[model samples]
Target: MIQRAETEHSKELGCAKHLLLAIGSANVIGVSLPASLSSHAGPGAGQGRSVFFSDGVSRIRLTLDENSPVLIENSGETAVLTFDGPGGLISVEGFVEKTGCHCPKQAYITINEGCIFSCRYCNVPNLDKHIKTPDEIASLISDAVRRENVECISLTSGVVGTMQEEDERLFAILERVRPFGLPIGVSVYPTPGLSQRLFELGVSEVKFNLETATGKLFAEMCPSLDRDVLCNALKEAVGIFGKNRVYTNIILGLGESKAEMKQCITHCLENGVIPIIRPLTPSAQLSHFSRPLAEDILSISEFLQSELLRFGLDPSASKTMCAKCMGCDLTPMTDLHLGEVTP
Candidate 1:
């Protein structure tokens, strides 16, 4: 019985590896596909090529011709799959076909000083530079949404001030941008009060990145912040915003076991949160640290998708919520939920 159990476990692991390879290779191939080909492909086809696969529990169909585009629609209209490339996977429920919202161009605004947490894998510099005023930040966002074709904007800042102060600044930023009616996503330290503030600001989603799976490694990476605090924050966010609106970022290449990653994802789902899994993109300063193989990312994505099904989550059900505004089209050609906004 012991030998049989070991064999079953080994098979499962091997299957996970293959799925990761498929996901990674799809990413590479997707990036290489020509713009013309991508433009011509239909909703279900990626660069005119569609890859389909089923692993008994789940059926995943994706287009791999550009930037590893994937469309995971299960049971007609259950859940929708979104990938962060460097984070993990996000399975959104109640998939609507809302038009994509325009966002500002990517710009780093100096919000505060260095991060209090010393994450071992992070390469972000701790610069003591001037911070951009709310007006300056608002102007950039307006341009991105109005001129540049941006659909969704993600705002992140280095940890600044005490937990209380950080929460204040985050709320201030969200309040400043709420007038635009854009779907904004913010990443912040896990603080329950702050999470509530974000939801109150009409923010569409919140991300509390659990960079690694293991508690021991998490402690080693972010020695300053308390892990329990992070967990509580995630729970609070989920409780406030439905699970579909709460996301947790997971970095895969930081020396964590598959089982550990699964366990972390399970916890997130149990608390009504989505795991946004992505591969490790080490900065040039930390190029010495090897990234997790592409296979590893695919494996994790498959695991999350399968687990989501078990929890009665459907990606197709959570389609884009803003489909009428066509100011900027950000939906991929392969996205079945392509709203009236054309990309």
Candidate 2:
């Protein structure tokens, strides 16, 4: 019985690795015939027009007949299928308002959809800009909670004009949704004294993405921001939000070597911030870099899982955001409590 269970667990992990590869690949392996998605739950239950998929052990909500950045291929009746996307498969409950952000576990919303910075890998500036009012977004939060089982909320926005202006808007939205009691995570540019300010505003989590792992890569991929400023801000974040509560996103395919990746992860661990390693998802004009190899992410994830444990940090202990979501990457923090992965 023990041997059988071990074999089963290995099979599941192997399948997960394959899924990660498909999800993290940049080029499409095959074209899928388009189909129309019909709701299969609630008012649309029993309708064959919808399909469900599980990323690792996480149940994902998906529409059958639509084109998502994450594409499903060779789908069988059991929904045991492979999905392709630059980023690993995430729990996309659906779009919020009209931004490209995916609400994996709970809610991922964009305060506005235009960026002022010119990051080499982001296509946000190439698209049409969108803005939302505080009340409109508050209504969105209410609807998301009412209509869906949205547990927490993550917010992102382009640098509308100035960092201060964007911060004001974010604070306003927080005021409107503060009464909901949902754990809120915000991803924004770090301004002077902003972490403490946001922390005081009841923001539960925050991410200021140092997308590139090293200063050299930062200059090559994203020259708009000062790398030192972001790094300094992360230290402040750890001080204010505590370890593992503060986070940053590091995309894997931006010319960062394994050594660079290790250094980056170590830096984050040393500073008490959890680095969310992401694949360089291709889209818009930013589709040049190849998708990261899944094995690389898996290797790093295994290291990070151990690193987190070493630091007395636990992703599962996080209150909100990507560590809690664990959808976009192969981080093993999501798998620590499982029953030996028997299934």
In candidate 2, which residue ranges exceed 4 Å CA deviation?
1-22, 25-52, 59-78, 82-101, 284-286, 335-343
Per-residue error (Å), model 1, residue 329: 21
- Per-residue lDDT over 233-285 for candidate 1, one digit per residue giving the tens place of the 0 to 100 score: 88888778775677666767677889999999888888877665655545323
TM-score, cand. 2 = 0.76
Worst 10 residues of 1 by lDDT: 324-333
lDDT (Cα, 0-100) at 218 in candidate 2: 92
**Cα miss at 89, model 1 (Å)?**
27
lDDT by residue (tens digit), candidate 2, 79-103: 2333332343322221111111243
All models, RMSD in angstroms: 12.9, 8.8
Query: Each model's TM-score, in the order given?
Result: 0.61, 0.76
